[model samples]
Target: MAEIRLENVVKRFGTVTAVDHGTLTIEDQEFVVLVGPSGCGKSTILRLIAGLEEMTEGYIYIGDQIVNYVEPKDRDIAMVFQNYALYPHMNVYMNMAFGLKLRRFSAEEMDRRVHEAAAILGIDELLDRKPRQLSGGQSQRVAMGRAIVRKPKAFLFDEPLSNLDAKLRVSMRGEIRNLHDRLKTTTVYVTHDQVEAMTLADRVVVINQGVIQQVGAPLEVYDHPINTFVAGFIGSPAMNFIDCRVVQDGPNILLDGESFQFPLSATKDGMQIFSHLLGKEVILGLRPEDIEDREFVKDQKEGIIKATVNMVEPMGANVHLRVASGMHHIIACVSPKTRAKAGENIDLVCDLSKVHLFDKETEKVISKSPITG
Candidate 1:
């Protein structure tokens, strides 16, 4: 395993900038995932690191070697593509052994590595099956197995599970994570799926419009996004953003969203960070889970806000309520037992401690709940 580093990397496609000057370090044996929407340069960045596509500027280092001019085959990196890039005519055994054969490995060495990788991937029984006869997931495993036999310094994956069914994607996700834990190989993965990034990464790199937005562990980035784009991008159902006016009544600081207002009872540090904007426009961000059913919350530190239910979507574990509080339309994830009906008004307890404040002008996060939560 080896650490991978990219320094001021830039990749341009003639008139379009595919990847701006982006720098990142992936520690040895760590699994880092690059995630963003399509055309956001995630795949381009991954290809740059793999030397599949040359960077227009900057340098890529694998371990102690600068690989900017290194050929992909000599870069000591193995890549697993979205399409599994397997040999259609070769059986699993031959395909997995092909790389070793090209590199002039002894017959015993090739057989040992092939069987070991197949056993590790639980694909021992399918060694004789041709790629044409394999399922999507099996084909993907064989693709990964091909990389494993090489035992390269690092493994690069480009949305390897995209072609699989949802259930298969989830199952493959665990298998990949488990493989990482066991092999401790340095891995750089690229995907547009936030769920996959959250589940399979040691650190997630959020890239958008060819720029790096934020880098952190899954929950760290989720709980405290650095900007509006990341706030709206990281989570499922997404965080709700309502433009509100800050009104101070006596000792309480309240946000008046033309339709409804929620009290801001921030901790001492939180207050110090946001108290100056008491009378200005600020964007209030609250996760769906942060808005709870009034009946379930015993302690209501935050005042309840009434909203007219616009839609009710029942997900298995929780119910999603789309409600309008005056001109602001937002979603609240509440208990499945919530009896709130469409067109009816209901009170939702906005947990002030869970609130996030962002500057209206800069669009950068101003403050967020303490990490203890």
Candidate 2:
């Protein structure tokens, strides 16, 4: 295993910059995921690290060696592509053993490595099967086996499970995580799926428009996003944002939404944080899960909002509500027992302790509530 480092890495194609001055470090044996939307330069960063794309500027290091000009074969990294780049003509065993064969390993050594990898991936019985005969998940396992046999310093995966069905994708996610845990090889995975990044990564590097947005553990990023982009992108159902003005209602500070208003809970931290923003417009962010049906809440008097339910989706464990309160459209994930129905007025209580405030102009978070276990 090796620690990988990129220092001010920049990659540009003519006038378009794909990666802009990115500097990060992947600790030895750590699983780091590069996550963002499509065309956000995550794959480009992976390619740059794997020596598949030349860096327009800056340097890359594997261990202590600078490898800006190193050939891909000499970089000691194995890459698994989204398409599972397997040989159609060769069976699983041969395909997995081909790299070692080219490296001129002894026949016995190659066989042992291939068998070990096959067993680890639970593909030992499928060794004689060709790529055409294998299912998508099995084919992916073979591709991973190919990478594992090489015993490289690091592994790079570029959306490795994109082609699988949803159920298979979830299954493969657990398999990949288990593989990483057992092997403990330094891994860099790239994907646009937030769920995949959240589940597989020890640290997630969020990118947007060719720039690094935030890097943290999944829960850390989910709970305390630095800005609006990170806040909206990392969570499922996305956080709802409402534009409101900070107003003083006598001695209490409140967020005024024109049609409705709620007093800021009298927490010492809340007072200190919102005192300076009086009379200025700010964006209030609330996660779907943080807004609950008032009937289910223990304290129904605080942070109450009345809205007309626009739509209702009954998920197995929870009901998702799309409601309109004044000019804001909000989504709330309430308990499955919620009596809220479409076209009816409902009362929802916001968990003020979990509120997020962002500067209207900069869209950067000014205050985020502490995360509880």
Candidate 3:
């Protein structure tokens, strides 16, 4: 219902900083997700905006009002916590109505709000059941139902799906997104789960060690990560990082790896960035999905690198291969019928267009694909 903005926000505990000079604006009716590893200050940012934790320095604005010193209740935000926080003694109906009742709404009004919320969440039949009688998914629905009835300025969810089983988590995730679509409520969700962040958010804010790494649409960040940390952390199997020294053979920029030497493509802008770094060390990053079985490769002879498979994990749709090339270990995802067995030398084709280059010292991605221009 309202936009949330944090400008130059700083939250510190003694000598350690949890969030450093953070500035971000969540547009009205937009669903934004704060995603990072644990202890990376994402939850702190949420609490800071929720007025649960006072900012050590800087200002927080809910809508146009500067709420830096406002109380949590006065901020008019609803938070769905990880633990669900449902009172065991109260049935689903009572739990959903508690907030409205406290605000002194009439019985008829409470009935309207509670029933509307329960219908929205598809928990109308479970309204008479206590928390003890419900499943994990049902309990979470009750928690969400409670927040829906309040109709707060914005919704903040802090790993609310952590308690559910994997299958239920997937189902609940869809349910929550659908609910957001219908309500059009401004929502800020925090999660360490990159998959959840990728699937649920309109925009993802990546944080690490009290610093903002990148902020963009999930696929945008995944396709063109700003740094090695963002590149590795955002993907499921994690991007493969190989240490190599940059090589310059006249006009061509080359990467000389452990057992492979390949010329960088010229499809990217600013070749001057790599031209000066020849002979300097850099990290070559490739996603597992980009490496495929050589036999199925389009350009088999062009960018194939040979490595010995160490192990193979047979996932239903694809097989994951752990391969060793000289001293470096890399994982590759290939078809289940790859025919590449453990200890066998296999020709793995690298999709050059999907490869990444990172500065060894700063660890920032040089480009999405090998830069040519």
Best by lDDT: 2
* Model 2 lowest lDDT segment of ten: 364-373
Candidate 1, residues 5-49, lDDT tens digits: the string is 989999999988999999999999999999999999988988888
Residue 17 in candidate 3, Cα distance off native in Å: 1.2
**Which model is ahead, 1 or 2, in terms of lDDT?**
2
State, as a TM-score between 0 and 1, how close model 2 is to the true structure: 0.97
> By summed lDDT, which 10 consecutive residues of candidate 3 come out lowest?
265-274
Tens-digit lDDT track for model 2 on 267-345? 5665676789889998989999999999898656767888999999999899999999988899999999999989999
Clashing residue pairs in candidate 2 are none
- After superposition, which runs of candidate 2 have C-alpha atoms over 4 Å from their true positions? 265-270, 370-373
List where candidate 1 sits over 4 angstroms from the true fold. 266-272, 298-301, 370-373
Pairs that collide, model 3: 266-372, 268-372, 271-373
Candidate 1: residue 233 Cα off by (Å): 1.1
- Backbone clashes, candidate 3: 3
**Which portions of model 3 miss their true places by more than 4 Å?**
266-273, 371-373
lDDT of 3 by residue, 36-63 (tens): 9989999999999899898898999999
